[model samples]
Structures are given as C-alpha cells and as structure tokens.
Target: MKAIVITSPGGPEVLQLQDVEDPSIRDDEVLIQVAATALNRADVGQRLGSYPPPKGASPYPGLECSGTILAVGSSVHRWKPGDQVCALLSGGGYAEKVAVPEGQVLPVPEGVSLRDAGALPEVVCTVWSTVFMMSRLSPGESFLIHGGSSGIGTFAIQIAKHLGVRVFVTAGNEEKLAACKNLGADVCINYKTEDFVARIKEETGGKGGSTLMMLSSQLASVWYDISVWCFDAGVDVILDNVGGPYLQRNLDSLNIGGRLFLIGFVGGAVTEVNLAPLLIKRLTVQAAGLRSRSPENKAEIVKEVEKHVWPAIAAGKVKPVIYKSLPLSEAAEGHRLMESSIHIGKILLIP
Candidate 1:
C-alpha cells in the first residue's frame, strides 16, 4: 500500500508518498481498496504538527474515504467482498488499502459516484450527529452557522433547509455568502463586512434557536456578543468545533438550560472558564471526538446516515460541494490548499 506520511510536521512539504505494508483486518473489520479521500481542517492541523493521531491510531492523515471492499473478516456477516462503501475513519484513509470495523462502513447512496463518495462521510456525520441528533434541531427553528462556505457549512445549510429550518450563515466574502444563499441560506452574513451577531438578531427579531461555529481566536473575544445576537435569551443549542477561550463564551451565550457540544479545537487548547456561569445558565457542556467512539456508537451513526443522510443524496436534495480534486500523490497539495483557506468546500485526493 502507498500512503502519504508526514516525516516532521511544519508545512505541506513534509508530506511524502511511500510504499507501506497493507493493513491487516481484525476479525470484526473489513479491508477497503480506497478510491478517494477527502480533506478537512483537521488534516491541516495534522500537517502542521498541532494535531496527531490518537494512541494506537493510524499515522496517515485522511479522516474519511470511499472505496470497495476487498476482504471481510469472519465476524462481518452483513457485508461481503466487492461491496462499494464509504467510511468514517480514525486515520489511515490516505492509502490504497485500510481496514475498519464493519459497522463503520456504509453503502454508497444511489446515483453517487465511487470517487465522489469521499465527500459524504465526515460532513454528513458531523452535521447529522451534531445538528440533528445532539441539538435536536426542529422545523421552523432559526439556525446560524459560521464559515457558511465551508464543507460542513454547505452540507449543514442544505440539510437544515430541507428540514424546514430558516438558515443564517457568516462567511468572509460576498462570493462565499452567495454560495451559501444558493445552498438555501436565508440570511448570509459577510463577517468581513458585517457583524453576524447584529444581523442574526435583526433577522430573527431575537428568537434565534441554534448556532454552529468553527472555533477561532477572534470568535472567542466576541463570544458573548455573538450569543447576544440570538434574541429571546440567546441560542438554545450550539455546536462548537473550535475550543479554547471560546469554551467560556459558549457557556455564556447559551440560554438557560441550553447545551453546548464541543467536537474540535482548531485554536490552541488552553482556556479559562467560569464555573459560576455554568451553574447560573444550567448549561450542559460536553467535549467529545467522533473517531474514538465505540463500535456500537459508530454503528448508530451509520444507521442515522442510512435513515437521514442517504435519501437526500439519492434524491439530489443534498449535493457534495467539492472545491477541487487532485491526484493521490498530491496529498501534500491537498493539505496546502486547505491551509490557504481559499476553497469553499472539500478538497479531494483521488487515487
């Protein structure tokens, strides 16, 4: 198997392609012959040495992939060899072959090409699990998302709109906002030119329901102000991918009895929090990683994919937003593109 490995994280130049031993499948796992893998902000952090694989996890840097099964372990009864699948992986997806627990793999939605299936796993899992499952987003609610042109944002806008939620988004520019609008965002905020908190309050008349933000240092400073944008005692639920100082603000922004689900830390991981606010707000703050979930939890997410995500893709109501695709060997370039922050959606590496 050939894979993109980082010798010393600093820049994209650290990534090198090399031949490696194929992965061995566990009794409950299946081996996939990968066709493509998608890039995420985590990959950039991995390349720069800020993020590393969890203990005993793959050193390779892909988070999701689409491929065909070559072999199945004896414990896998429902699927067999030659099954076309897409999977959420802890790591090791940037290779020709990778093995994963059987329950983590899902059949490609109808009408979706094998190569493009790489775009499905991470975004679908993130949005569905966070926005729908955890936050319990309901129809007629107002949903606000930061980085509206991002892969996560694009998928979120479409899915929330499909569920009858009024969507609001914040992006860096007009072109990005227009892209979000085209994806069904009802209110698009150009964070560069306008204040998202003010606009959201103006649009919702102070009854905003949910807010999703990828953590950033600047966002942390204005966190409470942003929460104020959600009228009617602030937002009820927040899905925060970035942690650090924002953690304190996330708690402050929530309405009484609100919930905050923390999933990532793009910003550095040290921040101070006031415990008193948590008690006063009756807030529920939890930090978790999807990659480390139990096999049963992953299976539940896969089931959710089948029930809620697949149909949207199959019916063309949800579409993968691909910023660019490069050859597998250019995995370095793929990471480079993501770091540049010029792309509007997922960048893929096709083998």
Candidate 2:
C-alpha cells in the first residue's frame, strides 16, 4: 500500500507519498480501502514532530477516514466486506488502507456521500462527546463555541441548534462569520474586531443581569435600555479549542454554573489566569483528546453519535461541511491549507 510518510520533522514539504507495507488487521479490527480522509490540526502537529501517534496506533498522520470494508477480523461482527463506512482512527488515514477497530466504524448517514463521510467522524464525535454528552447542554440553554466557522464550529452550531440551544460563535472575519450564521449560529462575533466576551455578555444578559428576570415587569425598560444594560450577561456553556489565551475570557464568559469543554490548545497551552471567576461563577473546566482514548471508550462515543447525531444528519438538519478535496498524494498541500486557516471547513484527501 502507499502512504504519506514523514521524511522528517519539518515543514509540509516533508510529507512524501511512498510505498509501505500493507496493514494487517487484529482479531477485532476491520481493514478499509480508504476513499477519503480529512485534515485536522493534530495531523499538522504530528508532521511538525510536536505530536506523535499513541503506542500500537498506525504511524501515519490521519486520525479519521471514510472507506469500504475490504476485510474484517475473526472477532469482528456487525459489518462485512463491501460495507461502506466511516471511522474514527488513531492514525494511518493518510494511506490507501487503514485497519480500524470494528467498534469505531460508523455507517454513512443516509444523505451524506461516502466521500463527505470522511469529514464527519472526527468533528462529530469530538463535539458530541465534549459538548452534549459531557457538558449536558440542554435546549433553551445558550452555548458559545469559538472558531465558529471551523470544522468543529460549523458542525457544533447545527447540532446545537438541532437540539434547541441558542448558539454563539467567534470567527476572524465577516466571510467566516456569515458562513457560521447561515449554518444557524444565533450570535456571530468576529474575534478580530469585536470583544467576544462583551458580545456574549450583552446577548445572554449575565447571571446577575438576566433579561428574562425582568422580561415581564420591565419589558418597556428593556426595550429602552437594551443596549446599555445588555452587556453583562453570560452563556450557559462554552466549547473552546483555543486554550491558554482564552482561559480567562472563557471563564468570564460563562454563566453561574457554566461548563467549558476544551478539545485543543491551538492558541498555546499555557497561560496565567485569575482563578477568582471560577469560584464566582461556579464553573466546570474540562479538557480532553480523542486520539489517546481506548477503543472501548471511543466505541461508546461512536454509538451515542449514531443514536442521536445520525438522525439529525439523515433528517437534513445537520450536514458535512467540506471545503476542498485533494488527492492523498497532496497531503502536504492539505496541511498547508489547514495551517493557512483560509478554508471555512474540513479539507479532504482522496486516495
């Protein structure tokens, strides 16, 4: 099989496609002939030598893919050869074939094409696990997600709206923010121009200044003072990937009992923060990674996503956001595009 090999830890130019040994499946795994794979921030980090695949995982960089099942191990059930599926993988997606634990495979949703399915597993599983499953985000609650036009952010907005939450997002420009808006983001904040914290506070009307509290008695006053008094509220939950620089602001943006789920540290991993807001807001801060989780844990998340999220996709309420598709040999270009941050959503690599 052919795969993208990291010639060395350096730049995108180091990613070279070359012949490699074909993968063999374990007793509980399935071998998939890759149709498409997606670019993720972790893939770039892996290429740069900052992040490496976990032990026992494939050495290649891709973390998710969609393909047809070519063979299944003896212990595997529920799928067979020729079955079309997408999977969350630890590595090896930058190849023509990848062996994945059977539990991680997901049937392509009814309306999504097999190629587009490649973009779903990672962002969906990440958002579903962290925001809805872990944070317990409920309908009518207000939620804020940074990088609103990103792969994670675009999907998060649709699913959050599908579940009836009011969505808020922060992007770098008007084009990205407009894209986020069309996808159902209720409040769009351009982080480069607007103060997200102030925008969120104004829209949600903080714990101490909830507009709902005075809606009935002060309806007229609210209409008159909406602009002046609205900038104090906070959201019920926040989903953030940019860590460090966002820690203090994310904490300050939450409601009294808000939850903030962190899936990455794109903004740098360390920062000094005032811990007082944590106590004042009674906040819950959590950070997690999908690649390092055990197969059994990942299986649980895949099942929940199948049960809840698949329906939304099938019903046309949620859809895959693919920005571009490139040949697998051009994995380097995919990495370059992702790093440039000009694309609005997920980028794909076809094998």
Candidate 3:
C-alpha cells in the first residue's frame, strides 16, 4: 500500500509518499478499501513531530475516512464485503487500506455521498461524545462553539440546532461566520473583528450570556469582557478545546455551578491552575479524549449519530462542511491546507 509518511519533524515537505505493508486484519477488525480520508490538526502536529499516536494506534496521520469493506473479521457480524462505510480511526486512514475495529464503522446515511462521508465520523463522534454525551448539552440550553467554521464546529452547530438547542459560534472571519449562519448558528462571532462575549450577550439579550462562558486564555484580553459578560449573564456550561494557560479565565467566566468540559489543548498544554474558583463556584471540570474510548462507547456514539444526526442529513437540514478534496498522493498538501487554517471545513484526500 502507498501512503504518506512523515520522515522527520518539519514542514509539509516532511510528508513523503511511500509503499508500506498492508495492515493485517484482526479478528475484531475489518479491512477497508479506503475511498477517502480527511485531514486533522493532529495530523499536522504529528508531521511536525509533536503529537505521537497513542499506544497501538497507526503511525499514519489520518483520523477519519470513508471506504468500502474489503474483508471482515470472522467475528465481525454486522457487516460484510462491499458495504460502504465511514469510520473513525485511531490513525492510519491516509492509505488505500486500513484496519478498523468493526464497532467504529458506520453506514453512510441516506442521501449522503460516500466520498463526503469522509467528513462525518470525526466531527460527529467528537461533538456528540463531548458536547452532548459528556457535557449533557440539552435542548433550549445556550451552547457556544468555538471555531464555528471548522468541521467539528459546523457539525456541533447543526446537531445542537436540530435538537432545539440555542447555538452560538466563534469564527475568524465574516465569511466563516456567514457559513455558520447557513448552518443555523443563531449567533456567529468573528473573533477577528467582534467581541464574541459581548456579541453573545447582546444577541441573547444577556440571557444566553448568563448561561454560557468563555473558555480560551490566548485571548484573555479579548475574553476578559467575556468573563465579565458571562459572569454577569450567568453562564451554565462551557466547552473548552483550547486549554492550558486559559484555565484561570475559564474559571472566571463561569457562573455558579457551571460545568467546563476540556477536550483539547490546541493553544498550549502546561498551565497553572487555581482551585479557589472551583471550590467556591462548585464548578465541575472534566478532560477527555474520544479516541481513547472503548469500542462500546464508540458504538454508542455511532448509534447517537444514526438516531440524532443522520435524520438531519437525510432531511437536508444540515450538510457536512467540505472544503476541498485532493488525491491520496497529495497528502502533504492536505496537511499544509489544514495548517494554514484558511479553510472553514473538512479537507478530504481521495484514494
């Protein structure tokens, strides 16, 4: 199998196309003839020699893919050869074939294109597992999603909206904000120009503000007002993908009894945290990784997507936000695009 390999830590140029051994199928795994794979921020980090794959995961960089089952393990009962599926991979999705646990695979929803299924698994799994399952985001609750133009952000906005949750998003530009609007983002804040905290308060007439809080410290000055605004408005829950240095602000932005769910530290990892706020406000702080979840837990996420997310796709109320598609040979370019942060959605590589 020909796949992209990161030869050393450096720029996109570090990624080289080479032939590698085909993955052997395990009794609990299925072999997929990959039709497509999608780029992720972690891929770039991996190429830069920063983030290493978890133990026993694929050394390849892709995190999600759409493909056909070529062979199923003897114990794989739910699917067989020739079934079209999208899967969440721990890694190694950038190849012609990758072995996946049967439980991580999902049938392409009705009316969804197989190639576009490349956009589904990672975003759906990440959002559903973090925002809905772990955070307990409910209907009518004010939900603020960062990176609104991102693949995960777009999916989060659509899924929350379909479930009757009030949705807010922060993007880098007006164009990205417009895209969020098309996907039913009630409030779209351009972090490049607008103050999301203040704008969120104004949009919800301060009601949503009181129930949602800011979660990034990279923009402490910018988010300081958010801290004040959300505190004044009384925030209930917050989803923090950028952690580390911002932990203090996340605490400051919360209302009494608010929940802060930390999923990633795209900003920086090390931080000094103060416990006084956590003690006084009775805040619940949680950190998790969906990729490390058990097969049963992953299957539950797949089931949730089937029940809650697929219907929206079938009804055309929400569509996967795809930015571009490149050939498998151009995997480095895919990583380059993701690193540039110019795109507002998923970037797929067709095999």
Candidate 4:
C-alpha cells in the first residue's frame, strides 16, 4: 500500500507518497481498501509539526475516509466484506488501506457517492457532537459559526438551518460569504473587511442567542474581542475549535451557566486564561478531540451521527460540500489548498 508520510514535517513539500505495509486489524476493527479521503486543517498542522498523531494511531495524517470493506475482524458483526462504508479515522486515511474500529464505520448514505462520503464523517461528527450534543442548540435559537464557507462551517450552517435555527457566519470575502448565504446562512459577515461582532449584534438585534461555533484559525487573535461581544449579546454555549489565547475569552463570552466546548488548538496550544469569568459566571469549559478518543467513545459519536445526521444527508436537507478532488498522490496539493483557505468546502483525495 502507498501512503502519505510526513518526513520531518515542515511544509506541503515535505509530504511524500511512499509504499508501506498494509495495516492489520484488531478483533473489533475492519480493514478497508480506501476509495477516497479528505484533507483537513489537522492534516496541515501535522504536516507542519504543530500537531502529532495520538499514541498508537497510524503515522499517516488522514482523519476520515470512504471505502469498501476488504476484511473484518472476528468481533465485527455490523459489516462484512464488500460492504460500502465511510469511517471516522484516527489516522491513515491518506493510504490505500486502513484498519478502522467497527464503531467508527458508517454505511454510506443512500444517495451519496462513495467518494463524497469521505467528506461527511469528520464534519458531521464535529458539528453534531459539538453544536447539537454538547452545546444543545435547539430550534428557533440563533447560531453563529466562524469561517462559514469552511467544510465544518458549511455543514454547520445547513444543519442549523434545517433544524430551524437562524444562522450567522463570518467569511473572508464576498464570494465565500455568498457561498455561505446560499447554504442558508441568514447573516454573512465579511470578516476581512467588516466587524463580525457589530454585524452579528445588528442581525440578532443585540441578543446573539445561545450557541456560537468557532472554526476560524484566526480566533486566537480576536477571541477576547469576540468574547466581550458575546458577553453583551448573551451567548451561552460556545463550540470552539481554536484554542490557546481563546480559552480566557471563551470563558468571558459565556453568560452565567454557559458551557464552552473546546475541540481544537489550531492557533496555539499555550496561553494565559483569566480565572475570574469562570468563577463569577459559573461557566463550564470542556475539551474534546475525536482522534484521541477511545473507540467506545468514537462509536457513540458515530452512532449519534448516523442516527441523526445521515437522515438529513439522505433526504437532501444537508449535503457534503466538496471543493475539489485530486488523485491520492497529490496529497501535498490537497494540503496546499487547505492551508491557502481559498476553497469553500472539503477537498477530497481519490485513492
């Protein structure tokens, strides 16, 4: 099998496609012949040496993939050889073959292509777990997501809108903002030129609602400012993907009894956080990472996603937004596109 290996990670140029031994499966895992995989910011962070794969995970960088089952371990009963599936992976999705825990595998949605299914697992699980499960965003609530044109942002917008939430998004430019609007974002703020806090306040009439989702890498620099705005607007639940400097602001942004779910540390891993807001507001801050979770935990999230989100995709109420597809050998190019932040949705690597 061939896989993308980060050789002394530095830049996209460091990713090398090389032949490697195929992975073997555990009793509860399945071996998949990957059809496609999707690029994510985590991959870029890994490539640049900022993020490392969890202990015992594959050295390869892919986090989600779609493929056919080649074999199943003795305890795997939900699927069989030849079954079409997509999986949320801890790593090794960049290869032609990977062994995945049965719990993380999902049957491809009825109407979606096998290749496109690769794009769904990561974004869907991320959004459903953070926004719906953790944040408890309900119908008629106002929801705001940064980087509205991103894979997670795009999916979050559609899912929130489908559930009757009014959606607001911040994008870098008019084109991305327009794309977000077409995906049901009620208010689109051009973060590069305009003030998102002001626009969000204006759009929600000074009450920003309960749930806020942050997906932008720029969150570290502006999280404090955003937090002050959230404080004024009464934000109660925040799903944050950018960590470091944003931790304190995340606490400050929440109303009394607010909950903050931290999922990623794209900006930086270390920062100083004020403890006053936490004690004064009685806020709860929890951190989660899918790639490092136990199989049982991942299975729970996959089960919820399959039960709740797959139906939406099958019914056309929500769909995977793919920006480009390249051959598996072009994994470096995929990383480049992801880092450039010019693409509007997921970028797939066909294997």
How close is every model to the real structure, measured as TM-score?
0.86, 0.93, 0.88, 0.87
Across 1-351, the per-residue lDDT of candidate 4 in tens digits comes to 999989887989888999999999999999999999999888887888877998989999999999999999999888999999999999999999999999999999989999999999988998888888887888877666767899999999999989998877778889999999999988887867975655655554555443443333355466432222224443555666678866765565455676777777766779987565665567778777777888888899999999998888889999899999999889888888888899999999998
Write candidate 2's Cα lDDT for 1-351 as tens digits: 999999999999999999999999999999999999999999988999999999999999999999999999999889999999999999999999999999999999999999999999999999999998999999999999999888999999999999999999999989999999999999999899888887777787543443312222256466532111222558989999899999988887888888999988999999998665665557899989999999999999999999999999999999999999999989999999999999998999999
Scored by CA lDDT, what does every candidate get?
Answer: 0.79, 0.91, 0.81, 0.83
The per-candidate count of clashes, in order, stands at: 1, 4, 6, 0
Ranking by lDDT: 2, 4, 3, 1
The positional error of residue 343 in candidate 3, measured at the CA in angstroms, is 0.4
Global CA lDDT of candidate 1, please?
0.79
RMSD of 1: 6.7
What's model 2's overall lDDT?
0.91
Best by TM-score: 2
Clashing pairs in 2: 202-230, 205-233, 206-233, 206-234
Q: Where does the lowest 10-residue lDDT sum fall in candidate 4?
A: 223-232
For candidate 1, the 10 contiguous residues with the lowest summed lDDT are 223-232
Candidate 2 lDDT for residue 280: 52
- The CA lDDT at 32 in model 4 is 97
Which is better, 1 or 4, measured by lDDT?
A: 4
Stronger candidate by lDDT (2 vs 3): 2
Q: Where does candidate 4 clash, by residue pair? A: none
lDDT string, candidate 1, 1-351, tens digits = 899988897889888999998899999999999999999887877778877876767899888999999999999997899999999888888888888888889998898889889988988888888778877878867666767788888888998888888777778888888899999988887767875555554564555444433333355466531222222454556666667855765665555676777777766588876565565567677666777677788789888988988998898988899989998899888887887778998898987
